[model samples]
Target: MSTLSERDSLFLEIAVGEKLISAQQAKLCKEFSGAVSENLVKNGLLSTEQVASLQQKVEDKLSSGNKVAVAQVEIYKEDTLDEKVVALAKERQLISEEDEKNCRKQLKKLYDLGYNPQLSSILYSAKCISQEDLMALYKEVEPNAKVSIVAKSMPFSELSLPTVPTIGTLKRKTRHEEVQQQESIPSETIHMLDKMEEVVSQISAPEIDIASEIAPLKQEEEVQEEVQEEVEEQPTNESVAPTPVATPMPTATTVTIPNFDKVLEYLENIDYKVTKLQQDQKTALTEALSHEEMEERFDSEDIPDELQRIIKRLRHVSEEEVQVAIRDGVGLENCYIPKMSSSTPIVVKKVNFTNCVIDQVDFAGVQFKNHVDLGNSRFLTKAIFKECHFVKDATFKSCEFLNGADFAKAKFDGKTTYNSSAFRRYVSFNRCGFGKKTVFTRCYFAKGVKFGEVEFTGPASFNDIFIDHRFYMEKCQFKDSSTFSGARFADIADFGRSKFEKETKFIGATFMKWGSFKNCKFSGSANFNTMNVVGDLAFDNSTFESVVNLRAISASRNISLQNIKVGNEAAFKFLDAHIGRLFVSLSSLKGHIDSHIQEDYHVARKEYGLLKNNFREINEYDKEDWAYLMEKRMERMEMKVKGPLSALKRFLNWLALDIACGYGTKPANIFVTSLAMLVFFAVFYFSSGTTEFVPSGELALDHSVKIEQSMSFIDAVQVSFRTFTNASIEGWVPYTDSWLNYVMMFESFFGFFVMTVLVVTFSRKVIR
Candidate 1:
């Protein structure tokens, strides 16, 4: 009894020899437990159905006792056999050791270059061994001597057959009998019989010469003709009974043995044809089942009589007939069209309507299992595909829809593409669902298009698409990344209240009309980089939970970003963006707006300037002041410091314009600075005792009547105020000998400048 492992190994070896599995696959199968076919299926090396078929084949081969022949052929393909052949040939003195070494070196080179050449073939091609010597050596080295020769000599089917007698055997027997009956045999005849015996001995050899062996048969025929003539000349007295004759062997011309290479080629052709036929049958069966299942589903429903008639027509008619009906403007309404193929009607797989002109048709509730192509087709009237399901790739490349088209509530579970298609009238894909990557590249929509409430579970692309009418994609949900790169809108393009859960890009898109993304929500990065808008664009009340890139965006009209919310981790990139007018307020941003532009001063400066101008145009005075202050600050930061003088100028500019008065934008800063300066001077004058009070005489004008006492804080304040106002007080003056007089002049000059700025700012506010 064979062990399970031994049986599995035998089965796998046969499978490998039949090209069902590779030799490496067979080796891998042996490392695992269970039946070889089961292990192969488990490892995904072969399908379950394929393994079952292979098991059947292996069983048949084993029962037929051809396992050894297959196993020996597999061994001959291995490197171990190559080494054995070289060693046995050397042992027999057929090739020297140096030749063997050279052959090994050449074989290694061939192996390095990804070639798996046989050692016998290599030696024969290099003239190191003759064909006869190589074949004899292989026979001796191989475990099954007959397999070593017959495997190469004939096709696999013939090699597996049981041993049988050859035509040469009967010929040899007949020639020997003729020689034995004769008193004397010719020298040529004797030699020919000896050669015939040798040929009969090596009957399995493919190299046997039939032409040389058949020459003796021709001589025997000539001899028989001469004997008949001699017998006729003798003249028999009594009537002779008719003698029965033996059936002559077929001549070489009549029974020609096919060449070994041609036989192998013919066998390979047969195998290929059989495999193709099996695959075709399997496909046809699957398609038939699908059609029957769909028909059963419809039969169970309470549909109308017209719909039932249409369904029956669609099922019974051939694909060409349906195409002809479509071309003839037949209304195929409410029909469940089975999958169609033109060349092989039995295998109804893909449905192709390429370059056809179709009329009005409704394919409601149909399911397409394989590829559905309508490339270069023209739809003359309204086409409806409500609630249809595409189970594989669907293509509508270069199709023209002269009338409107509707695909409401359809489900696409495969890659869907629409390249260079045109819709002249209104089209809708509302409530459709996509399960894989969907593309609409270079499509043109003349009338309005709607994709409301669509669900996309895969990446969607609308690259280079052009819509001359309104485009609506409201309330849609994109679960994966999507792009609209290079798309152009000639009219309003609305994506209001949509949600994008992954990265969304609109790179290099152009909107000639208004574009809206109002109330949208982005859970991932939203890129509008290098976008251009000729009309107003709005993102009112939208939410961005991730990075938003608006780099190099150019809008000729207003861009409204009112009441938008951003996440804390979200960032905005407005690098080199040019907006004619921006409508955003501080209260509009509900979360942290990452507009920290300190890293790039040049961009920061431009961005701040744009904000300032926009705010001023909107007449939001407080926001304008803030934007103006930020602009000046960014400009000062951008200023390059060269020398000490330039550095001092920069610092002074910062102190005066930014810190002191907020670039004349903040009126409160000037008043605060003036009061602060007044207090400082007043404290200095009082603490230093550098001020005196002068009293006037009553009757006459006195030049100076000074009270040489310590000036109080009130007198110090009065003197500082009077000096700052450039007015003289009647009773107080700076002491002549004190160095505070120069301080007073400096304070007055600074006070005058501060007062001038205050007046100018106040006057401007009042005028405005």
Candidate 2:
């Protein structure tokens, strides 16, 4: 370690230069140690936030045990650095038997000129070596090399490489050593040399393509050392061979960390960052911006003059290069050359940069005319995709959005898929438009996937979509409906105030941690069959225009149906469902009664009770009392209506009461039925010729009394009215010996019972 005095001198000078400390403060701090001096100077000029940030960085460094970390790389268990170096050099055609002498000399020159001896190591640190590529490289070297991990290796900068001798330069010194070395060399070394030559003579050679993760513009001031200490240098002696290493399995690889603060600053200040253009292009851009009175949407008409110029020059961009294009705070834009020839396909290659740390990448207003595949990619920093238009199919499978991702107002005209992905932080898809089918299958959202006001024009699939933490989809509009089959939620799965226009499906879905669907509107058939919810399923103030099939749901918790408006086609078909409790309103219960969907009696019993009580609380006693009677009626209806005897008895009771007055619940039915019966009986009496009636105070006891006076319709009605009222009147007397006498007797008894029932029912209705 550097001496305290030397450190103090260095730190004090730095503090003074950065204006973080006054000259006098620096002078006073110069007497202390480096760390103490830094603290004192920081306290003198810096705010608490700045001091805390610096302290955090210091703490991280101290905990890491590396004063100046070069690679920020860790050692792997299976593969050693020597093996990787050999593989990379051989694949790059830098080290081979035919050109071994030249390769060594070139390496020596590069090392002497202060260049990193391992450019491949640099790429590895940048997370460029994929698992597939690494395994392939390992297999090729495993046969010839007895690979082993070196124990307690030195730092990368201090490593000593094994020097390879020149075969082309056959000098006196080399020839003498070669003759003696060949005799003393181990058989394994000879075997390895022979295999190396054989590998070169093979039919096909493996290719080594090295590219860093998110090799963006070098617009910052960070010069990182590329040597990786995880890999040890190989043995230099040709006589030694069969060196075995006891290595375990490989685990997570290393990644090169760029200067994060500089990258962040660059991204935040990247206003109007555009591609480099000539004078003519600049003029076209200026003219295009000038023609726009307001910020227009995605059409060529907004920038017609610019677009026409671009039409002449623009070709299809089939390949996107990943390299640093920034220097000295100015973006040296990468040439987006179009590969639009007949020989080249118009589709661009994958925009994949796994484990790459890229800052806010503004892909706004970019139009993908062809397919774009970005699978297994990661954006470690923030990203922006506002107003981006995908004219064709686009895929982003197994990608991660680590930082915030903004995809607001983006348009997808074709199929867009994001399968088995993860979003660690907040993400937005607000106000986005989907012209074709879109999918987000089995994706995990650690934070809320805020997708408010989005319009899905085509079918959207969120099958097995998991909200690992929180979920939000307020006011979203599924214009063509969607499917969320097998979706699992953990915490706060809120989809409040959304709209579904067509068929919505949630087949086999599990809303476990917390479920909410408040104030939503479903204008079509919604299938929630087989959905399992361990939490409350809130649908307060929801509206269903058509059917909502919750047939086989297993909501073990309560479900709220407060103020919900279900259409004529829908009812809670909780046949096999297991709901703990329910919250509903009177109007909603009335709807369920009208719909009369099949449900378990035990499950429905509690809900009916609740409905009745709620109605009473709201001063709707008529409905409450009716529901009470209806509840009992429903129970009776469920009482095994299978056999003929039970059916006959139920039919008799229904005829006696429910058909006419709904079991004393409907007074209108009683009045209408009684009035009709009275008229029919009166007409029957008027048309009959079996009996004659005499207008007297007494009745004739014999059938010999003929019709002295013809009985008219008015006289028959008056007699029928008197019999219905049960009034004693100076009226006609019936012939007791005639068949009409018995009929009149039965009618009088029935009329008395009917009048009594009507009076009691009317009194009950009025009192209640």
Candidate 3:
């Protein structure tokens, strides 16, 4: 074994003194050459953090030159026997981690309240462990463990050293030794031993003189045997059995005790009945006192008769009453709490007020440390929960708020649910913070609800929420994904300037009035699919950093997307939407538009036409033209052809309308087409060998005697221009007898049609 360092010695002393590790474990750790802290952690005696904490304390003592005393270091107290048993049960997977934590918290709470409760009792009270399991665990930890029931009326001082039955020795072994010996004991024998110990431990009497007590019974047994032997020796020869003399009864002073097992059984039954009666009496006393307090408080208040009646029915009539009802399955009913304002906030745990009718109550600045349920309750007046901090799950399911409810600045650190609840008046949750998953599904808000500046650090759901008045969530932040799917807003719903840091969904939602999302930012995909709006819905001045799906949406009025920026990787989908009028700025049209519906030509065409008409209505002619062009392009690209002939025909149609005139939306295209045609004809006429041009004067002379000349490029251009305009080509004419005359005639007809198209396109553009 290595010699212990000063630090190691101090650590060992603290660990053993604090009972963090048994003395035997400490000795074993010291025998090893490794570091003390490392050995403690490796052997599962302490966690690394615990070792570090202890090491810090040791170092502080050394630096200050103060001697370490067990009494001075009271921060780490020893675990009680019940705590060890509960911990062993947890280690053996008999209880969950959450259950263990709850047990510890309850035990601490009881201790703080001046009640010295055992961990086993707390766990049993919480229904986390059963009586059988508790006894089994105790036996595993201490084979000779005894369970002694204490009356509820016993004081803490007396209860601490509960009288141990003198049936056996009460020596306790360290946990390490217990574990080493537990393997050899059969499980059945252990269970029987536990039962025997429990039965024997119930007798709280002092030690008895066993020899004196049994001496009378031993003498009576010997007398009965001697008399029986004498009768048997004389019975054979006599006609009648010798007159049986009754053995003299034991003296009255000599107590004849019953069988030992019978005595134990009788004592156990008496103990059980006494314990039960004590518990019932304690519960009755507590309730009676609580009720009297409530009645006195109620009588002192000069409230109305109707309110008094409601108050009388309430189980938890005051804040003080709430404390007494903290046990499991106890709920407040029809509570009527007055305005409470205190510098020190009240702390409550696991309060349930389900199905109650509560009047105006102010819980401002209160800190709730455990699960709170006010579900299915009716709040008769304005309920204020401002600045309240909920450290565990809070539920308000199916609750009705007749008056407005204010939760402004409240912070929820656990999952919160308000599903199916109704707020008949305006509710304000402004500046609140939700730290875990929050649900407001299937809720009704008669008046507007304000969630302005709230922060949702976890997934938030407002699915199927119905709002009869304006809903304002302005400037709020959703740090995780949020959903408002199937929500119906009968009035204006404004989420202006909010930030959705993850995916947001508004699928199948209805906005009966104006829906504004101006200046908002969607950092993830924004799904507005299958939405319906009766009035204008706008995303003006918003930015989408990812995909924006507006598929299958219907609006009876205008939908606007002005001055918004879409990221490069973002895609905009407006497929199959019933848009009455869209007011989108051209700058906002970034990323892929209608890329998903491109394969369906008809749907794509209809969508583009809607865009075109909307832009035209807004006087955005350039955007209108772009929409129109896309409409035609979709038709050309997605047109189905069954055969070569149909394919040829489709190609011709595209060439004529789209290539030449930009599908009648671009007059500039028409001009370009005409110029290209003129140039091509001029080149053809100049290059063809059979075609020749005659001068105007020569044409007037004899037809046969005219000298033929090849047309120069400039002369070909002049001839083509005049022929295309169908004007009098007085200075040039094709050879009269050659096949070029027919070609020239055909060119004249084509020129006339092209000129008509150009005129129509120009007139339309100018007029529009």
Best by TM-score: 3
Expressed as tens digits, the lDDT of each residue in 1-768 for candidate 1 is: 223554465566556645778877776766766676777777787887777776775565444422111001224345677668777888888887766665555555444322344555445434567645665666566635322211111111221221111111212334324433442434443333232232223234333322232222323334345435533643264222111121222121012222223322332332223344344433433333344444454555433355444445442434567655434434333233333322221212566656555545566777776777777766655777778888988888887777778999999999998889998889999999999999898999999899999999999999999998999999999999999999999999999999999999999999999999999999999999999999999999999888888778999888998888877767667667888888886654323334553256667666666677777777877777776777687788888999999899999998887778888987789999888888888888788662333422222223254345556788778778877878766645654555676999999999899999999988877776
Candidate 2 error regions (>4 Å): 1-321, 324-349, 354-374, 377-379, 390-393, 468-470, 479-481, 488-499, 508-523, 530-546, 552-659, 683-699, 703-731, 752-768
Residue 513 deviation, candidate 1, in Å?
2.9
Sliding window of 10 residues with minimal summed lDDT for model 2: 246-255
TM-scores, all models, native as reference: 0.53, 0.44, 0.56
Clash pairs, model 2 backbone = 81-231, 125-256, 148-245, 216-324, 217-325, 217-326
Better of 2 and 3 by lDDT: 3
Model 2, span 473-541: residue lDDT tens: 888889896999999887778889999989999999988766778899988888888998898899888
Could you list the CA RMSD of all candidates, in the order they appear?
21.8, 25.7, 22.7
lDDT digits (tens) for residues 1-768 of candidate 3 = 789876787688667756799878988887898799998888788998889888986776454421110000011234466667767987888788877675566455335323454656545544566546765666566554434332222111111112111111112232112322543433343333323333333344433433221211113334345434544654343222112111111111112122233333443343223344334433433333344444454454333456457655554455555445653336665555433222346555477877676655677888887788888887767898998999999999998887889999999999999999999889999999999999999999998899999999999999999999999999999999999999999998999999999999999999998999999999999999999999999898898888888889999888888788878766677777788888776656623564733466677777677778878887888899888888888878777899999899899889888888888877888888888888888888878632355665565233465565655788778878887888876666665565666777887888888788888978877887
Q: Each model's C-alpha lDDT? A: 0.64, 0.55, 0.67
Q: Evaluate model 2: give its TM-score.
A: 0.44
Error of 2 at 344 (Å): 21
Q: If the candidates were sorted by their TM-score against the true structure, best first, what order would they fall in?
A: 3, 1, 2
Error of 1 at 136 (Å): 99
Please list the residue runs of candidate 1 whose C-alpha ends up more than 4 Å from where it truly belongs after superposition.
1-348, 547-552, 571-578, 587-595, 641-647, 690-708
